[model samples]
Structures are given as structure tokens and as C-alpha cells.
Target: MDYIANYVDAIVIGGGHAGCEAALSLARLGKKTVIFCLNIEAIAKMPCNPNIGGTSKGHLVKEIDALGGEMGKNIDKTYIQSKMLNTSKGPAVHSLRAQADKVEYHKAMLKVLDAETNLTIKQQEVSDILIENARVMGVRTITGAIYYAKAVVVCTGTYLKSKIFIGEFAENAGPDGLKSSQVLSNSLLDNGITLRRFKTGTPARVDKRTIDFTAMEAQLGDSKVVPFSFSNSAASIKKNQIQCFLTYTNEQTHQIIRDNLDRSPLYGGKIEGVGPRYCPSIEDKVVRFADKSRHQIFIEPEGVETNEMYVQGMSSSLPEEVQIQMLRSVRGLENVEVIRGGYAIEYDCINPTSLLHSLENKVISGLFFAGQINGSSGYEEAAAQGLVAGINAALKIDAKEPLIIDRAEGYIGVLIDDLVIKGTNEPYRMLTSRAEYRLLLRQDNADIRLMTKGHDIGLVPDDIYAKFLDKQEVIEAEIERIKKVFVGTTATVQSILMAKGSTPLTSGMSLHELLKRPELDYKDFAAVNLDGPELSDEIIEQIEITLKYEGYIKRQLIQVDQFKKLEKKLIPENLKYEDIKSLRIEARQKLLEIKPKSIGAASRISGVSPADISVMLVYMEQLKRTERANDASVS
Candidate 1:
């Protein structure tokens, strides 16, 4: 058979959120990159949900934007409704979530990819990765075309040997009924990669006109919308928002699901793959949380032009007839018309432990894996991994140091560390509780934590980086001015304090000290304003957060310093864990399997104990001394 041959700097397989970011990052960095998708129309498609950024997932999107990725900016441009979640909580957990016009979101991302320099988007299925001497050489398409590159990033997402199950019926297909790549799974297994089968489901899409909106509570977008991207202007994204209806599943809905449990593929022992524990199917919820009286269901619009509405919390793999019955049992959805049936998709993913913190494969140099293929669950998680993998793949080809985001820096760091160091048994989802340094890694300050790294890596434009620096300078100057400016205990000041319900000042104090009070914020003191330049809201936010959490931030920073020490203690790539006699049998086996990059990472692994870490540290120190002695003797 005749085959076409092409060459590029990098090749990205799959065109979902992960592949889009990877391709864009590589192209922006001056690398000629090609991203192949099974269907071009599905580029950046949201198969499960028509929205982005929720809880810790928002932090990932912000970090991706800070590092010059496109998800945040795209969502901001195309969102139909936007809101800031967890407002009642501290700034650490506050997240920006937005409901997107699914079609517009895809169009916006596609436009960005199209405009990217040195990037070529192709419609093709990648069948196998080519390797030589355990290093990635390129990838071959199913059509017999070979694409040779310096590096190959597999962002296949949930398409590798994918199977969709709806009750007793099963078919080899990807999300939204797209063709699955059947040959890739075999190719991956043949290349010494350990593959795991994982399952995830999407809720049915119903016609909006059929839903009884008055019967359900109306959920409106925030009047003041918060943009996800630091670079995006909040004013530009603010607009009249759409409404999402909230409905609940009652005893009748539960009874229907309970009666159909035996018919579900999940309960029938038909699904071999492990599904996500956090985002479970309706059947799982009915059985597990049986004590609960009801479950919340969100009816979200798919797009402005379409009548399709996503049934948010009712993801299931029930039979088509049962699904309709299940939908009708709910309050507002009593007469709902189903547009698309919910189903479970099982796909082959590589064991994330096979990769390094940089997201590059340990055995196959220049090869990278991201997205669901890494066992992660959300679009944000996949995009974050894709950005890291793309950046590191380009760095490797350029003979530069690979970029690794540590746990304390951002949610991206915590996510990669958890995946590569502490491998997930099921599909992993990022949560605020997973990150110990959430205060320091807040979504609001993602730019502050990562923009400089992006600039240093050549992804951030010089002008944008200069703007970030200017914002930082303004924040610092305002903080200093506030600390020095003393407010007298005059009648006017006391009255202002009294109006704010704050305690009257007994003596004169710096404005900074007053700002530290729980009830008083920077804006509250405008009545007795001190001299300072007017600042952007962004700058003021940073100043306020820094002052308000100064004590807690300091403590976390101290913890970060301690963490840095262990992280700096690098484990030798060639070190033999089997040779350590003091290590427990399980610890040795786990260590050999994971081959952690540092002492900090090793300590986080489940089976590895504190005693194992201590023994490994001592052995490392002895090895260093032996190497030093040998060098001296040779001299």
C-alpha cells in the first residue's frame, strides 16, 4: 500500500481539550506541530458537560491560562452564563464556573487553533507510535501515513479502544458516537505500556421545550460575572446571562432507578472498567446514598441555537426505555423528551506512574501522555497535563530543562504529583481537599504563581508579562503604603468604624492593621481614605488577600520551604530499589513500580512508609559519599 510520509517537530494524537492545548503550546513555542483527530468537527468538544471550571477544576483552568493555554480564554469568550462558586467560603476555595454554549465553545477553540502559527490540524486516526532504541521516533496513522517527529504526545483522551454501553447494548465507539481507535490499545500494550480500563458516563440531553421550568427552581448567573482568564477583561465577558433550572430526584425517581439496577451494565458485572467514585451513575447513587431522600439535577442548555438541554446530575447507563421513565419520574422532567440517551464509555488508559512529573514517559524518551489516557476525569485536568506535556516535549527537543510544577505552586502541580507519584486506581478528579497548600494556590493568584514560569519558558508574550509585573509592583506598593499610613482616632474615623459595625479604635493604628480585622476590608475604609494611587480591582484584590491572610500565608510558606527540601533530594534514575535490604517488601515493589523522582514524592505514595523513606534517604547519602570517594581516588 502506498503511504504518505511527513515530518514535524512534534505530533499530537487526539483533538479534545488536551490535544488542543498541547498543539497550541508547541506551535506558540516555534515548534512545527501537527494534531490529528478522528473528526475535525469534534475539536475541543465537550462530550459530557457543556461547561468548564468547577471547584478545584477552576484552579486548573486558571493555571492553564497563566501558562498561556487556551481553555480559560475560550470559555470566557463563549460562556452563556458565569458565576463565582463558594463565595461563602474563604478565597482559597472560591472558584469561577461558567455554563458554555457548547457549539460556540468548540468554534472559539477551533478558531484559536486555526490561527496558531506552525500548527496543522488534520483529520486522521493515529494507530501506533514508532520507537527506536526505547525513544519515540514518531507515529503512524491508520491510513498508512507516517508522521516522524522529534517528540510525540499521545492525548488520545477517551478514544482508545473505547466501548459505550447502554444497558445490554454495547458498541465500539467514542464519545458522541464517534469512531474509536481500536488499533492504538494493542500498539500501546506491545510497546511495554501498562493499560488500565476506566469508565465514565454522561447524562442524557433532553429538549428544553418539554421541561416544565416553573416546576423547578431557577438558577441564575451572577449579576457581576467573573472571568476565568487573568488576561481576559471582566467587563468584556459581562453580559445578560441565561438561566439553568434546578430539579431534584424524589422517591419515585429512586424507585425507578432501584427497580432497573439489575438492568444496568454497572451493577450487572458487564462493565470491566472502574468508573469514577466522585461522579457516579444514578444507579450507584441510588444504592450507595440510599439514606438520602433526593438528589439534585441541573438542567443546563446545550447552546443558544439548540433545544438540547443536559441533564447534569443524572448520568447513567440505563436502557433507553428505562432512561425515559427515569427522566419522567423527576419533577420538572415529568414530560421530558430525550434527545440523546445517557451511556457509559470505557476506554484504555496508561498507568500514570509510567510517566514522570514532567509528563514524559520514563522508558520512552520524547514520548508524552495526557488527558484521560493518564486516568484523570475533567477537561481542566486534561488541559493542564497537555500544557505540561507539550511544554516539556518542546523543551526536550530544544535541549532545555523540563518544567515541573511542584505541589505547593498550583493545582496543576498537585494534580500531576498525585497522578505520577501516587497513581490513581480509578479515574482521578481534582478537589480542593487534595491540595494541602490551597491558600497559596488559589485560582485568583494563578497568574502570580505561574506567569513568570510561563515567561521564562517563552510561552508568555513579553508585553503580557510586563503587565503582570506592573500589577505585582502596584500590589506591593499599596501594601507598603497601607502599612505606614496611620489613621487617627478622630470622631470621623470612629463614626465610619461604627457605621461598618467594626469596633471603635481605642488608639491610632495603621490602615493595614485595620484591614486585617475580620469585618473590615480595604473598600470599607474609603470614607477615611488615605493618600494612594487608584489601583485596578485586580491589584486591590491581591493586596487585600495578602494582608487578610498574612499569618496563615506565612505559616504555609514555611511549610512549603520544608517541602522544598525533600523535593530537592532527587532520586537517581538508575537507583535499584531491590538492593535496599532495609526496605519492606511492599515498599520495594511499589518503589520499583513508581520510581519516584524525589523523597517528597516517595513519601506521598500509599504503600511506601516513613521508615522506607528514611532507609532510602540514608542509602542515597551513602551512595553520594561512595561516588565522592571514588572520584577522589581516581584523581
Candidate 2:
């Protein structure tokens, strides 16, 4: 009997956020893409929170939207609530978050997938990758069906050898009892890929009707909702939003957790994966912060159509009985029934050092990896990587140039660079603090920062590109207008300044100079016939920040210039680090194993210090001068 198998330009393993983004981007770019999943119904499933975007994470969603990805747009369509966080802080930290109707989100994304011309969604577990002579040829599913592909993306997320833990009990399953890809672990190992175990946990889901809203502070979404996509239809996103309640876990809640600590998989040492320190489970919280009397617990509605609510900040793998006890002890959750138990999931991912800046494997040419499979923990982080990997994969097949993002541009760039360079020991999560040039790289300007790249890669549409250009023009005009406006110490201006606690101007000063004062802004001098062009709040914000932090921003830009110098000093693909004189033994060994792309990357790797970078920089410089001298003589 002759058997037939399907062929595609790209095979994306896993239908999670990372896989979905990778598959969609590839298809939209005209590649024949197939997305392999454990369950078709679980496409774009939110295994944990029934929400999207927060702080730095929101920046990612907007950037994805700017790049023509579907997450922000889909989330906007299905969101039950929306809010802008860090309002009291600077615009750089203001993040948009939305509580979504989970079912609707999944359904909406699936419809997009179904409508995509070149993408096929298949319900199958990818068990093995077919790599020959260091280039990916195809993938083999668990059912033994071999799908031929020119390039393959392994976005297995936390599904490879997944283990879910509740208390001391552990079961081999993905987040929602889905089958683990055990065979894939062996396959990755067989290919000489280095592996690491990492863990992430989700809190219990509660019956929404049981929570007492009166006992908690009502958290409301922003009134003027800003959609994630630059192409978003302005057909009013405002609606009656769901309110999340905040309650505190008292001494009793902590005591219950402390008493039952040994029963937790994390505390019991039953789970081996290195979990993220920032998003630790409830059991970890109690153990690490014994002195804290209470912790904030947020009760968030899962969806408008369902009565389920999420118990935030109470994530634990404690015994079921103890979980019920501790949850009930919380302020507003007195009679909360345990609809689902909180648990931690451990899974296998490759040490990202094994991957290149392009998210493609150096050893396996056409094979790429992204998301949790690369040890990054957030949905935003995963999706961002997926876009990069998918783009590079298509470029690989097209024999076009690969895309690489340095740390200065966007958080996505910072994320990939950190993952490949630092080689995280624990599950990597993106934090705004991780970005070196945070002052310039902010959530507010993600579209401004990366939309051009998206356009260049054919991800962003021309209409969106035009809008970005308009936005840039408006910001520049407003800044110029403000710089030209002048104000004097007239009674009107002096009185207004006095009222606002600003020092009286000594003769006359430019309106821009007054704006640079800590107390006054351009908006405050509205009476003086504003000098700069009239601008919207958004554009005004850009003007103010640019004027105020111009010097600091310039300094960081200089640092970026110096950094790129090292980043450009590429390590020869087959350079023998061992042959480099005065290089430390550990440096030589690590350099050989990791095979970093440049001196900057090499400097970040463990055992390679500033001294090692200097040595490498000098060697590369000498080689460069020699090559130039040789070229001059030839000419």
C-alpha cells in the first residue's frame, strides 16, 4: 500500500500563541504553512490568565499589532475590560491591559486562521524533527505521518515532556491535561541540542458568583480605550467593562500556606524545572517572605459569558485540601469553591545559547525555535520570538536576508538579545528594567520604534505605514512649535506660574524652557498663545519627553553607537577560540560551545568578561586592518 503525506513550505509545531503568530506571519507573507496542535479547539488558548497585556507585556502586544500580527486586534475584539496601567507614572510605563472573553478570543483567532489563504491548522502532535546535514527537512508526528517542509519551527512551548504538579502529585500532561510530547524531547536530545527544565504556574479558577465585590477595591479599565493595532477601526471600543476586585491575604492565609509548605511540589523538591522568580507560586511567596503579613489577591472575571473568575497572586501547587483552606481564608473568598486547583507546570526547552540571533539553530540551518521552547515565559515574549523566527524561516526559504534586532530599538529586540546572550538559567520573562535604553525604548513608542521594520518585512500594510508617518510628523511639528513659543514675567504669566508653585521668571524665557522646568509643562501655558503647533495629548507627550530628556537620550544613543561596534565585530564561523593566545580555558570552551555571533554577544556569555571582550576586539581589529591593507595593495 502506498501512503501519501502532506507537504508545506513551513511546518509550525504547536498552536499556542508562539505557534499561532509564527504560522500566521508565514502565511501572510505567502508561505504555505501548517500549524500542528494537540487540540484544534485549543488554538490561541490562554492557559492561565483570561487577559492580555500588562506593563512591559502591553508594549509587546501593541508592537505585534503595529507589525500586523493578530494578538492585539483579536484581544480588542474579545476583551471584556480594558485599562491603562501606571497612569500616575511616566508615559513610558503606561501599559494597556484587557480582560478577554477566553472562548471568544480563541474562536476569533481560529476564524482568522481558517480564513488565512496559505495556512493549514492540523490537530497532531509533532514528535520528531527531520534534520539532515544540519538543515531541517521536515517533521514527523506522533502518529508517524511525515510532513515535508522546506523549513520547520519548533514552538512546542511547555508541551515537550510536560509535567503538571498539584501538591506532591505530578502527572505528565500539558497545562490542561493534554498529551506531552515525550518523543520530541528524545529527538531534540538526539540532535545534540542542550536542554533545560523550566516551570510556570497558574492560580485556581473561582465561580464568579461566589466572590463578594463589596469587600474588595474595584479595579476599572481606562475610559478612552486605545486599541493595540495601528490599523484598528476607531468604531468605539468603549463598553461597560468588568471590574476586578482586589483583596488581601491575611496572616491566616500565610499561616495555612506555611503549615502546608511541605505538601507543595515546589517546596517538596518534586519539581525540577527552574521557575521564574518574579512570578513565583503562592507556596514560594510564603517561604520567601515569611515576615510579610499579607499579599494582594486579585479576583478577576474570566469572561462576560462565563461565571468563572481567576484567583490572581494565589498560584500554588499545594495539596488540594490546603488550597481550599487557604483560599477560603482570604478576605472576599470566604466560601469560594475550588472549581479548579492551582498547579505548576514543568517542561523542557533548549538553552537559548544553542540558538542564533535569528532564532535559527546554527547546527540545523532551516530549523527554528521560539516561545517557551526557547525558555521565555510570557505570551507576549513568545509571540515576539515567533514573529522573528517565522520571518527568518521565510527569508531562509526565499534565500533573502535574515532579520536581526539589536537591544536599542524595541523590547522585543532586548528580549531576543538577552535570551541568546545571557542564556537564562530560569524561565526568562520580559521586564522593562531589562532594557538598557529604557528612557528611549518605551511602551508608548513601540509603533514608532519598530513599525518600519514590520513594513520592510512586508508585515505592516502601506496604509498603516502612512499613518505612522503622519504620527511622526505631528510629533515633530508639536515639538518645534513649543520650542519657538516665548513667555515673559508678565502679571498674567507670573500669576499663573505662582499659582502652580513655579519660581517667577526673571525677564523672559522660551515656552520650551518653561516646559523643561520640573513644575510647568507646555499645556500649562495655554494662555500665552502656544508657540508650537496644536497637538493631541499623545503627540504633546512625545514633544515634552523629547525636549526634557534630549540630553539623556543622546547619551544613551552614544552608548548604543559604542555597543554596535562590538556587536559588529563578528566571530568567524569556524574560528578556533583555543588558538587565540591569552584567552582563558573556560572562555575558549564556552566560546566554542555557544558560538556567539559577535564580541558583544561573547562578552555577555558566562566566563567571558570585559577583558576577554577587549582581547577579541583587538584580534578582530588587527584582522580587519590586515584585510584592508591587502585590499589597498591589490588596488
Candidate 3:
């Protein structure tokens, strides 16, 4: 028997968030790319949550959009309800979140993938990677067909030997009863790739008809919707949105969960995976916070056209009967009929430390990994890694320089750096709190921070890059004008302040200074007229933030300068750390184990300290001196 032969510039294993983005990016960059999945209809499926973007996840979506990825545009076109979370707080925390039409999201993404000129979507399970020596040659599907490629990105998210459990019942299945790739897992293990099992749960989908709206409070989306895509005109896409409901899990609901704790796979020793700490099961929440009498459960619409409502904050793997019992016990859900029973899924994930900063395996060239396969937990997190992996893989194929986002630059940089440098014991998820420089990495400025990189990588179009340049110029011009323009304590200014409920200024100050006031802002000073600088709202956003957080931003900039110095100090790949006598045992062991590319990456490793960094610096200097002496002698 003969098998078919396929060839492509790049191959992506898996068709979820990471795989979709990675394959699409590679194809969009004009590379011939093939994406293998169990089923094409399951492409870009949101198995766990019906929505996209929340808090820092929103920042990732926007950054993905700026880089010419499909997630933001797909969500923007399909979202039923949209919201800007944390609006009451500072602008730094403000994030755009939306409830996407799940079915439509999948359809829209598949359409883009299918219509792309250089991309092919395949329905097959990849069983093993074809490796020549230590470098990835390509992948072999279960049907025994070999497809050769220059690079292969393994984004096999939560489907490798996946098992779903509900109470005492368990079966091999990917999330949502999809086909699980069980054979490919042992193939990876045989090839020396270690596996770590992680667990994630989805909430029950309830029939909207059975829900009692009168007993629950209505949660509405924000009147003004913000599109996640940078390419979108922002104004043209705005429209009327859907509403979500809010219900509470009372003490009765807790009692039902407590009564069946023994039956839960997580509580029982049935699950052998590390679950996400941030998103816990309802059982975990009830047990962990026993003192609390109630917990909030969001009734999120799965889609505007569908009758299924997602039970957020209530994910579990209780038995089907228990699931129904638990749902009915919640206030306003007395008659709820579950469209689908919730369950916990345990699947294989790799230790991210096994990969390099470029998301490629250090031990195996041309072999790359991203998303849940790297032990990350969110759709946004997965997509971010996919974008980076795809970009780097494409660059590798073309002999161009790989893209690297540093920890100080954007959240994507911080996320990948953390994954590679400080490997996680649990499934990794992105949070604003994870980055010290989050204020500088807000969603509003993601395009500005990452668009240039995208442009350089050939994903961002030249016209879009030019537009970004124009926007930057306008922002800088406005800031300059504001700094040069001065305002006096005139009645006009005083009246404006009073009207806006701000304290009246006793003395004159620069327009920039006035804008920096916590009580007074650029919009508040509309009553005062000056020709020095007139800013549009979007442009003023950048100016106001820079002026307001000038001190913090400057301090972070200094920190970044120090970071750059260390990052600039390149560590030779073949250097023998064991020969360095001055380095500490722990530091040397860590440096050799992680094989950090730079002194900066070495420092981020957990056990390595400042003293260790200093020691390494001195050792590197000595090596440089010895090298120079040898070169002089040779001359």
C-alpha cells in the first residue's frame, strides 16, 4: 500500500486557538502552511468558555490583532455582547471583553483559513513527528502519510490522550466529546518528550427557556462597544448588543456540591493532572471558601441565536444527576435544564522549560510548541504563543531573524519569558498582575508597542505600518504642544474645574501639568481654549497617560535600560558553565539546565540571584579578556 505525500513550508499540529493563529499567520506571511486537526468543524472551538478577552486577556487579543492575527477580528464580528471591564478603575486595567457567537466564531475562522491562498486545513490526527537526528523534519498522521516541512509547530492543545470525567464516570475524549489524540502522546514520549497532565473544567450549558429571568438580576453589556481589532475602523462595527444574566449560588447549591465531593474525580484520586489555580471548579470553590454562603454565577448567552446559556463560575465534573440537582438548587435556576453536563478534562501538556524563548524546542531544532500544550490555560494565552511561534517558525524557514518580545516590552514578551525561564508547576495563565510593567503594556498601546515587530515580520501590511507611524507622530506632536502651552488661574479655567467637580487651581501651571491632575483631565479642560495643541480623543489618550504616569513610566524605562544591558550580554551557547569556578553551584546548574540565551534570561531563572548575576558578569568579562589576548597572540 502507498500513502499520499504532502509538502509545505510549515506544519501546525492542532486546530484550536494556538494552531489556528499559527497556521494562519504562516500562510498570511506567504508560506505554504498545512494545519492538521481531527475535524475542521472543531477549528477555533471555545470548549471551556463562550466569551473572549477579560482583564489582561483583552490586551493579548489586541496585540494579536495588531500583529495581523485573526482572533480579534473574528470576535469583533461575532460578539453578541461587548464590555470594557474595569472602566471604574484606571485606564491601565481597562480591558475589552465580549461574548462571541461560538458557532459563528468557528465558522468565521474556518472561512479565513480555507480561503487563504497558501494554507490547507486537513482532517487527521498527527501521530508522530519525523525527526532527522535532533531536528524536526515533519509529521506523520495516523493514516501513515508523511508530510515534510522546514518547521513544525506542535500546538496540540488538551487533546493528547485526553480524558473527561464527570463524578465517577470517565472516558477518553477531548473537551466537548471531540476525538482525543491518544496514540500521538506515547509517540512523543518515545521520542524523549516528557508530558505533564493538566486538568480544566467547563460549566454546564442550561436551556434558556428553563431559566427564570424574574428571579435573577439582568447584567447588560456596555452601551458603547469597542472592537478588539486594530484594523477595524472602530466606529463602523458598533451596533446593538445582547445581555447576560446574573444569578447567585446559595447555601443549598453549596450543600449539594459538598454532599457529592467524594464522587468528584478531582476530590477522588481519579484525576492525575495539575488543574489551573485561577479557574477552579465549583467543588473546589465551595470547599476552599466554606465560610462564604454564596458565590456569583454568571448566566452568559452562548450566542444570540442559540438558547443555550453558559453557567460561569460553576464549572464541575459532578454526575449528570448531581449536575442537574446542583443547578436547580441555585437561586433563579430552579427549573433549569442542562443542555450539556459539565465535566473536568485531564490532558497531556509539556513542561514549557523544554522550549526556548522562540517557543522552539532547544533540544530539537525545527520542532516548536505553543498554547495548552505548553501548559497555558486561556484562549488568549494560547493565541499569543501561537502568533509568536508561527512568526518565529516562518522566519526560520525564510532565513530571517526570529522575533523576540522582551519582558519589558509587552505582555506577550513577559508571558513567553516567564514560561521559558520560570517554568510553571501548574497550567500557566496570563494576568495583569504577572507583569511589573503592565501600566506601560495597556491594551490601548498594544498596537504601538507590537505593530512595528509585526511589520518587520511581514505579517503587518506596509500601509498599516505607515498608519501606525502617522498615529505616533500625531501623539508626539500633541504631547509637545501640551508641554509648551501654559494655563493661568483665569475665571474660565476656574469655572471649568468647578463644573467638573475639581479643585480650583490657585496658581498657573502648564497644560500638561493640569491634564496630569487626578481630578482634572484633558476632557475636563474643554472650556479653556488654546491653539497650541488640539488633540483627538484617541491621540489624547496616549498624551494623558504619559503625562499622568510620567514618573512611573520613567522609572520603568530606567529598569528596562538595566534589563537591556543584561540582555545585550550574549552568552555563548557552547560555553561550559561547569568550568567556571567562581559561579555558585545552584547558578551553574540552573544556567546549564535552562541554557539561557542571554545574561538577562539567566537572571530571571528562579534560583539565580543578583550575586549570581554579578558572578556571571565577572566570569564573562574574564572570558572576553582571555579571548582578546588569544586573538592578539594569533595576530
Candidate 4:
């Protein structure tokens, strides 16, 4: 067969969310990049839920935006309904979730990718990763075209040997009946990459007109909107939002599910892949949580232009007849008409432990993997990995240091660390509880924590970085000024304190101290402190959070300092675990397999015990002493 040959700096396979961010990051970093997709229209497609940023996933999007990726900005532009979840809780858990017009979100992201200067989008299926001497050379497509490049990123998502199951029927297809890449899995296995089978499912989409919203609880967006992107102005994206409805499954729904349990692919021992534990199918939920009376069902709009509504919380791989039967058992969906039936998708994903913190493969120097291909489950997780992989690929090509965000730095750090070190048995999803440093990794201050790093890496523009610097200066100055400004127990101050239900000051105290009171905040003292310059809501939010959580933040910073010590203790790449006789069999085997980059990551491996880590630490110190002695003798 005649073949076409081309050359580029980077080649990105699969144009889902991960591929999009990876390609964009490379292109923006001035690398000649090409993104190959099975279908161009599926670029940035939300194959599952038509929403972005929920819980810790929201934190991931914010960090991605902070680091100059495009998910947050795109969601801000195309979201039809927006809400801040967990407002009643502390700021650490507050997440911004938005229901998007799926079509617009895809179009918006595609536009950004299209406008990128050094990027080219091609409709092709990458069949093989071309590698030489354990380093990525390029990729070959099914079309027989070979493209040579300095780096290659595989963001195949749920398309590698993808198989969809609905009841007893199964078909080899990607999401939305798209083409699946069959050859890549074999190629990956041939290249010495270990692969795992994982499955995830999506809820069915029903016609909006068929749902009786009057019977369900109406869920509305916040009256005052908050944008997800730091670059977006507060008032710019605000508009009248649409409504989502909530209903619950009754006993009848459970009965139908229970009666049809044998028919479900999951329960019938037909699904070989392990599904996500957190986002389980409706059948799985019923079987596991038998004591629960019902599960909540959310009816979300797919888009403004379409009448299709997503039947959330009811994802299953049951037969089509059973799906319709179970859905009809719900209150508002009693007469629901299904547009698309829910099904489970099983695909090939690599064992992420084979990759380093930079997301580059340990064996293949210039090869990177992101998204579901790395055993992660969500779009945000995929995009975050994509951003990191893309940035590192560009840095590697330019002979620069790779960007490695630590656990203390951001949730993205915690995510990557958990994947590369601990390794997940099933599809991994990010949660607030997973991050030990969630206090410092809040969504609101994502830019404050990551913008400078993004700017240094050339992903963030100079003007935006300058604005970020200005914002930082204002926040620091305001915090210092508040700490110095004293307030006496005067009538005005006492009255204001009483009005806010806070205890009156004993004598006098700094404004910062007053702001630290549980019931009081910077806003309550705005009238008394008339001399201070008016600050934007974003600035005020930072000031308030800093003062209120000063003690907690300081404590976390101390913990971070301790963490950095272990992370800094680099594990020699060529060090052989088999040489360490004191290590346990399991620990030695795991260490030999993973080849963790640092002591900190090694300690987190599942089978590596604390005793083993202690032995390794002692060995490392002894090794260092021996190396010094040898050098002295040679000199």
C-alpha cells in the first residue's frame, strides 16, 4: 500500500477532552502538533453527562484553567445552567457545577482548537505507536500513513477495543456508536505496555416533552451566577438559566430492576471489565445498597436546541424493554419516551504505574498517556492529565524541566500521584476526600496557586499573568492592612458586631482578627473601614478565606514541608530493587515494577510497607556515603 509520511513536533491520538487539551497545550507552547480523531465532529464530545465541574472534578477544571487549559473557559461560555454545590459547607468543598448545552460546548472547544496556530486536526484512526530504542518516534494510522514526531500522546479515551453492552447484545463500538480502534490495543501490548479492562456506563436520553416536571422537584440554578474561568469577568457570562428536575426511584423501579437482574450484563458475569465503584450502575446500586429505599434521579437538558433530556442516576446495561419499564416506574418519567438506551462500555486502559509523574512512560521516553486510557473516569480528570502530559511533552522536546505538581500544590497533583504511585484497580475518580491538602487546593484560589507556573511554562499569556500578579499584590497588601488596622469597642463597632450576631470586642482588635470570627467576615466591616480601597469580589474572597482559615492553612503548610522532604529524595533511575536484601518480597517486586521516581511515591505504593520504606531510606543514605568515599579515593 502507498503511504504518506509527515513530520511534526508532537502527535496526539484521539480527539476527546484529553486529546483536545493535550494538542492545544502543545500548539500553544509553539510545537507543531497534529491531533488524529476517528470523527472530527466528535471533538471534545461529552459522551456521558452533558455537564462539567462537579465536586472535586470542579477543582480539576479550575486547576486546568489556572494552568491555561481550556475546559473551564469553554464551560463558562456554553453552560446553560450553573450552580455552586455545597455552599452550606466550608470553602474547601464548594464546587461550581454547570449543565452545558452539549452541542455548544463541543463547538466552542472545536473553535479554540481550530484557531490554534501550530495545530492540525486530522480525521484518522492511529493504529500503532512507532517507537525506536524505547523512545517514541511517531505514530502510524490505519490508513498506512506514518507521521514521525519528537513526542506522541495517546488519549484514546474509551475507544481502544471498545465494546458496548446492552443486555444480552454487544457490539464493537465507541461512545455514540462511533468507530472503535481495534489495532491499538494489540500494538500497545506488543510495545510491553500492560493493559487493563475497565467499563463505564451512561444514562439514557429521553424526550423532554414526555417528562412530567410538575410531578418532580424543580432544581434551579443560582440567582447570582459565578463563572468557572478566572479570566472571565463576573458579569460577562451571567444570563437567565434553565431548570433541572429531580425525582426518585420508588419500590416499583426496584422491583423491575431486581426481577431483571439476571438479564443485566453486569450481573450475568458477562462484563469482564471492572466498572467504577463510585459511579455504579443502577442495578449495582440496588444490589449493593439493598437497605436504601430509593435513589435520586435528575432530569437534565442535553441542549437548548434539542428536546432530548438526560435521565441521570439511572445508568444501566439492562435490556431495552427493562430500561423502559424501570424508567417508567419513576414519578415524572411515568410516560417517558427513551431517545437513547443506556449501555456499558468496556475499553482498554494502561496500568498507570508504568508512567512517571510527568505522564511520560518509563520505558518510552517521549510517549505519554492520558484520559480513560490511564484508567481515569471523568472528563476533568482526563483533561487535567492531558494538560500535564502535553506540557511535559513540549518541555521534553525543548530539553527543559518537566512540570510535576506535588500533592501539596493542587488536586491535580494528588490525582497524578495517586494514579502513578498507588495505582487503581478500577476506574479512578477524583473526590475531595482524596486530597489531604484540600484546604490549600480550593477551586476559588486555583489561579493564585497555579497561574505563575502556567506563565513560566508559556501556557499562560503575559498579559493575563501580569493581571494575576496585580491581583496577588492587592490581596497581600489588603491582608497586611487588615492585620494592622485596629478597631476599638466603640458604639459603631459593637453595633455592627451585634448585628452580625458576633460577640462584642472586649477592648480593641485588628480587623483581621475580627474577620476571623465565625459569624463575621470582611463584608460586615466594609462600612466601618471606609478608608480602604474597594476590592473586587474575587479579591475579597481571597482575603476572607485567608483570614478565616489562617490557622488551618498554616498547619497544612507545615505538613507540606514534611512531605517535600521525602518527595525531594530522588530514587536513582537505575537503582535495582533486587539488590536490596532487607526489603519484603512484595515490596521489592512492586518497586522493581513501578520504579517510582521519589521516596515519597515509593512509600505510597500498595504493597510497599513503612518498614520497607525505612530500610530503603537507610540503604539510600549508605549508598550516598559509599559514592562519596569512592569519589574521594579516585580524587
Between candidates 1 and 2, name the one with more favorable lDDT: 1
1-635: candidate 4 lDDT, tens digit per residue: 72657899999998999999999999999999999999999999998999999999999999999999999999999999999999999999999999999999999999999999999999988888998899998988888899999999999999999999999999999998889999999999999999999999998999998989999999999987888888888699998789999999988999999999999999999989999999999999899999999999999999999999988899999999999999999999889999999999999999999898999999899999998999999999999999999999999999999999989999999999999999999999999999998999999999989998999998888888889999999999999888888999999999999998988888999998888887887878877898788898889989989988999999999999989999899998878788998999999989888888789889989999999999999998899999999999999
Residue lDDT tens for model 3, 94-164:
99999989999999999989899999989998988988899888988878898999999999899999999
lDDT by candidate, in order shown: 0.92, 0.85, 0.89, 0.93
Those runs of model 4 whose alpha carbons end farther than 4 Å from true positions after fitting are 631-635
TM-score per candidate: 0.98, 0.95, 0.96, 0.98
Candidate 1 global lDDT: 0.92
Which segments of model 1 are wrong by more than 4 Å? 624-635
- Considering only N, C-alpha and C atoms within 3 Å, which residue pairs clash in candidate 1? none
Task: Rank by TM-score, highest first.
Answer: 4, 1, 3, 2
Better of 2 and 3 by lDDT: 3
User: Better model by lDDT, 1 or 3?
Assistant: 1
Residue 359 alpha-carbon offset, candidate 2, angstroms = 0.4
Ranking by lDDT: 4, 1, 3, 2
Give the root-mean-square deviation of each candidate in angstroms.
Answer: 1.3, 2.2, 1.8, 1.2
Expressed as tens digits, the lDDT of each residue in 198-242 for candidate 2 is 999999998877877788899887777877666764355557788
Candidate 1 lDDT by residue in tens digits, 45-140: 999998999999999999998998889999999999988899999999999899999999999999999998899999988888999999998988
The TM-score between candidate 1 and the true structure equals 0.98
